[model samples]
Target chain A: MSGSDRTASLSYDRTGDVRMSSSRVVSLIARREILTRLKDKGFIASSIFIIVLIMGSVVFQVLIQSGASNVTVGLTGAPQGLSAAIQEQADIFGLDAEVIEYDDESAARAAVQGEEIDAAVIDGNSVLVSESLDDTLGAAINGAVNGLALARRLVDEGVDPTILQPVSLDVTALQPAADDAEEVGEKALVAFVSILLLYTLLIFFGQFIAQGVVEEKASRVIEVLLAAVRPWQLLAGKIIGLGVLALAQLVLICAAGLGGAIAFDILTVPGAAIATVVQVLGWFLLGFTLVAALFAVCGALVSRQEDLQSVLLPMTLILVAALVLAITAGQNPDGSLARVTSFVPVLSTMVMPIRVATGSVAWWEIALSVALMVLAIVVVVRIGGRIYAGALLGKGGRVKIKDALAAERVS
Target chain B: MLEFDGLRKSYGANVVLDEVSFTVAPGQMYGFCGSNGAGKTTTMRIAMGLARADAGEVRWQQRPIDLEVRRRIGYMPEERGLYPKMPVAEQLEYFARLHGMNSAAARCSATDLLDGMGLGKRSKDALEKLSLGNQQRVQLAAALVSNPDVLILDEPFSGLDPTGVDALAANLAERRSRGVPVLFSSHQLDLVERLCDAVGILAGGTIVASGTVAQLREREANRQLRVVIPGSDGHWARELGYAHVDSAQDGVVLLQLDDPSRDQDVLSAAMAAGSVAQFGWRQPTLVEMFREAVAA
Candidate 1:
């Protein structure tokens, strides 16, 4: 016999009993789950891919927005004073307009037709545009041109243009909405990204927990696992472990995106951006727990991987529906449908975050939504744990969900 | 000691186990044998707490088994289960941890058990990479890794080769000698006869016969005599009015004596017919005892 053989034989003689702690066992199981998943190449590759995608998208959005802000126009037979007036008007309207002096009317018209300039002003009178102008751009250009024409008319009438100019009136409004239009735009972007991240993370990690449960069942390792820990402990440990992994990946992606945006000057306030990330994360935990518990139950309903699709279809459809509702809510944040769904459990995970971003949802509504989600999670975990304990030991083909629910717990 | 007390279970209207009961004393090896769907697996499963019994309980040392006590018992289900993707050593160690062994102890125990099973060299290999028999050995190693106080193995020898059987039997004997009560179900009566101190034969969801090998064989002794007469036709024993002729072949006749005290009458009859070479009472084998129990 080898040394190990001798040791093995001696083990039977050695009768020291080790104490078992339920929490310790749960932690160990959780550690095993985390370690195994972290080592999976598929998980690592997907996480890195999502991070890169988020960062790349932020950079692309910044480039497009910056490009859209600047407008180039051609001028022909225009007064030097008119050029300065256009510059001043453009600055007031927050437009970056560059004037290119053309030698004659044909040059300015050709420039507008060739797309070199957005529009053209020929002889400080008629504006030339190949296509119809946007409202904001037209208003700014028409105002500038009309102001210069008025000044020229005043000079011809033997009155000084400066004396004819009306006294500027500066009226300050007392109250403003919490955020400006630009801030609201930024919030909408943040909310959209957050919702997308939540949807992706919930679906991916929910399936992950389900797959893990099915793997243990298929391999028959669940038998041994249940002997040591209660079914609820196992389920809780799996959800927590996978939830942590999903959160880590989510944080990485969000940080990369927001960091990229900040670096490119697209997002001005880091504090607000971080707050949004935190809020999304908080909702993610609630949504993930509810969905993941249900997933574990779904997984226990089948023993084979091939049968997983049938068992998991309803939950998948629910997730997809939630995502669709959230996206529609994103479109009209203050709509009645968005307001109603924001208080629902699964839909709220997606809707409330967007409402928090785009609309001024009252604090009480946020509280009610979170409370409802917690209630749903509690109910789901209770039912899911029971099903998991009952159906985990069943063998043969897929177990009927009704039968699993009716079956008695072994422990 | 491990006691299964009147475990009754049913799935819907189908009763899988009906008032099944047995006991395995300390240091005793109990062999559980049954026909297909005779509730052998169900009984073991209930004992291991993998399935709930409609009534009855599994007691360890006169106390009902709970999670704390269950952790000290080793169980191998009829359906062999091991994570195919996990390395053999890690899988065993994980099971040890589930059984309440600390990480370092689990590692050591897994290493030792694998080495004892002659799978030390293949410990690093994924379970799927090993041959079927080696995988079975690893499953057995997993059961032994916890150094359990009680063992409930459901068909541990179903798919093993001769060497695998011997190794498992030896390890089980070692555990038994160390005062651990071992209960395992198997169809191999020969191995069971050689290894088990007591045997329980189940039929129709109940134990039909259960006792030591000799005790069961003694219970089955019906005072049948095997008579070998040289140069005599097989019909002579039938002509002597022995109503139950168990078998007759090649001048040898096995007869169940209607009156055991009248054995001399049949013996004299055989002597008058021809020279009697051998005449003696027959001892039943375990296989014969099992068949009789099942048949009854």
Candidate 2:
């Protein structure tokens, strides 16, 4: 037989049994999604921008903390005993103060302007400052200068300076000590960063899923894809693929922030901070799955990219509401509202992580929140998959969500 | 053999396909023709498993075609879709992998298909960068990359130029020579008539007429006769007393004879009037047959 004739007969055998494993097909689709987005210049550039912002925040926090450690006072025409009195007061307040004497008030003013000293004790009793001092530092300087002026006045009035010396009063509080207060501040910062990360990641990646779906539908590629794989597989694969990308970007930004904090010695108790990060990452997976599924469904409802915004409005609103609630809840982690929201399914993904990072949340609450999130994810996936399969191949204008839900499943 | 049997589908109260059925044997090219909304696309979509039919099944070699079976069938949708931002070869390879080919095999197949489509140099170019015709070629290559057992294309010739049409025809011919059953829909009836082994004409969601191209022409010509005589305006056909006269022009008359046995009398009358140049019956073109099928 001729070559063509032989090949014709050979094709009969080729038709028998050529099926791929399900997971393999899903991975192939997932890989395509990842590669396509990774190659996109916009995705890459935005990822880098976020990392820089994270690192920048870390650096800013470090600079503010280090600047708080020292107080320098430039002196002009101060009394002979004033310097010793100021030193005594500084010791009492646990402040490190450096005294520099200049020739005149003008020189002291110049020194303050040049940042040679934080404040200047000009003409003995008047305090010259370039800007407003924080309450604690201002109080320390006022206390020292006032005490010396009182002593000098008593001596001039022919009264004994010892008799006029004020008694030292000590006060104690039931609240946490200074170090504990600093720890509280750090915890709040951690929670704030955690919420910010969750909000941005969820929003960014959620939109990624939506835009990806619209691209497929708008380009008419969904038909070809629907032929090869089940609708659920395509939906799940896209979510998982973009989820992986989002997680990678999140990890990089978080690592950059953590590394910056360590390098600048800004973060104390690094182990605890790292634990908070790990918890945030865990909650991110739940939050991402819940939102990504809805995004896909919304994406399928619109054939044009411009129509996506209207269809996605409800999802965007929900995410924004979650974020606002989470931020308000972060301020009072142990409050009743925060505690209540922590167990709510969609809200928990945003609230529970912040509460866990900042306060001593009960283990049962965290477990319950996670369970609720998982349940929500399951429900969303079922409904979202149906809508996606129903509306994906629909052409011309936008498909109504109600119609899509009512339409029969394609598969 | 690929068989689309008793397919029925409806959107809301409007029926898109009602009892649309056809079969294509291995190594044969079947042409599916229809006007807009005649269920040509719906039927192909059902066969590819992209859409579910309300009632009916697509079977391959006596087994119902499912996801696994669809993976082995190449399908080009009516509205061609590919990732505009994806590189040509990469997208094809991606599709091949989705169809169950190994990564290495997919890569090789993608390159081979692109090279065959005269897109070898543009393999790395994004799909959007290519001209519309080249993009269409890439879409076709994507369908063929898996070396599918059957090929189903909807309007594969729609946006193609003559050269593109020729290239696509050559590729499809090669597949057909390998015993691959190819079913495609097109409005270009001449191309369908020339290339297809069998033709199915759909109207109002039903298969109005279907058979081999020759068979359909012969069936349509059975009742119709075209008579031509030299030096006559073809007015002699009016004297035959046929109930229907299709047309008369250029000294030739096309008639639908109520009694075909009367053809001899008609021929004698024409000969008596003038020397007969062409008196044999004429075969209807695919376009003519499509109109007649849809009209009926």
Candidate 3:
């Protein structure tokens, strides 16, 4: 080859050739790992298990939507039109409302005396309506009945109907009500999917990175692997490959669930949250990485699969704590713990939901927390990689955490 | 070529290997025979870069061992390991990929090794479910599946049945024929005598003696001669008056007059019997040589 030709061949105009090479190697190693591990009965089975879990959640939501609520009510002497109106509104609101009709005021009053229904609307010489339910629904019935009665009396009194009924107060919520039935359903959906996404991603992928490292160590496969690649490379591969698997599962299951919801006109979540799914995904990646590395470091300290529980407790509790924080964050999101935990890497995975539950978090806070988590992941990868490399070659004895971190070059 | 230069290692104050050194050239099968706790495992591990030495270094091809060199060196620890839950074929192939073999190559090598070892039918079986001897074969196959250049095996024959031992010896010989240098440690002195081109005899955490089989035998300063005849009592030893190791009937005596200066006199005395069927001065087998070295 000529000199110019050699130079031309060497150059692809790929400015980041070294990075490209590194990533390519990482991708290949990770791909190999994923293929081998994914073929594992445990991995495949648990994946199927997760899919079932996700599908079960969908079924659960559907069942809950279709089932009758745990509330009972009775009505008496209500006008036919007003009762029909109340029942129609209740049905549309996904409430289980049962309206019972009574013969006379005394009879309706007697039923109320018997406590048969939660509420009664009685029409008589003086309008008597039972206040068993919310005032809004009760007031609705009252307004409808009282207006009709007043109009009737005006006619009876030979007065102009429009003149007697001069004033009315139209009570409305300070905030806007959703325009369409689908919007309300969509709002309900965002909360559920977000929670599901957070739960599945952390659990599925977190366990993966941990177990993959431990398998290599226990089987002596890591000895062979450590010969050819650095510990970080192996770990990064496991994390990236299995992490991708978990994320893919998430997208597939969530898409199927949401698609079915849309197809059946159940509930719809907003698309605005779709763009910010990256933020949630970002949080997951950071959290998964940190926990995965720490779990692996801990996993290396144990040899048997049975020992995983004790080794996994710290990470498990951290996860449980984070999840608990996240759930509590959903309720009264501005609470002190919720506020502090949301920004902390240890607690961020749990805290994102609370922020979403309440309102949009400050963009700066998202950036800062994500940045902090990413930085933590980098440090973890570095230290965890060292620990893994050092301990992988050792025999069945558990390597202490400190000894693994102190890098004395192996002969 | 793999070389260890002035390697020193110790477990606490108790020295395991003191300034140990050896060179394994291509196509050479260097067997390391040692008494228990002789530091053969430690030296081999340091050469494989698996263990850190207190002093000295391991060099491959006149330089420090690198990743590329490591890729070419197959290692089998005396303490064996395999993924218990992984299928046999997949387990071997997965380790092959770690050595830079593509998936297809790994699969092909794994299948071929399993088939050759009479385990083709059980390729998909879990490792833990296999018989211990079969697991040993699988471990051997994992080492060879990558077709490594320098092989380091610790006690490869220790736990093997007769057939498994034969399989391993055959495998190592084949690798030698293919010009892959091999370093292996074992207490099976007889097998090492038969299979190794050169042997390193480790005792008391150091190489007390190392040479070709003939050289090691020659290094012994005495001869042990066994003579048998059809007639004459154990007192035919009166006919052959020399230091005797053991004596047996009609006329049989293991003359162990270990003074090499008197080798001819002893041989001539045994040959004096006109009815002597066989008499020759013989250096001890490696098993005897090892016993003597350890005794020393």
Best by DockQ: 1
Tell me each candidate's TM-score.
0.88, 0.86, 0.78
TM-score of chain B of 2: 0.97
**Backbone clashes under 3 angstroms, per model:** 0, 0, 8
The local lDDT score (0 to 100) that residue B50 gets in candidate 1 is 79
lDDT of each: 0.83, 0.83, 0.69
Candidate 2 Cα outliers beyond 4 Å, as residue runs: A1-19, A72-181, B233-236, B241-245, B248-250
DockQ for the candidate 2 complex?
0.35
lDDT of 3: 0.69
**Model number 1 iRMSD:** 2.7
Off by over 4 Å in 3: A1-29, A36-45, A54-146, A152-193, A260-269, A273-278, A394-398, A406-411, B221-281
- Which residue pairs does candidate 3 place in steric collision? A73-A118, A74-A117, A74-A118, A185-A268, A186-A268, A186-A269, A326-A350, A411-B52
lDDT of 2 by residue, B1-296 (tens): 89989999998899999998889999999999999889898899888877789999999999999888888899999889999999999999888888877777778777777766667899999999999989988888888888898999999999999877876787788788878999999999999998998999999889999989988977876677777775678677776676367887887778877888788887788888888888777887899899999999
Chain B superposition TM-score per model? 0.95, 0.97, 0.84
A208-255: candidate 2 lDDT, tens digit per residue: 889999999999998899889988999989988998999998888888
**Chain A agreement with the truth for model 2, given as TM-score:** 0.77
When summed lDDT is taken over every stretch of 10 residues in candidate 3 chain B, the lowest stretch is B232-241
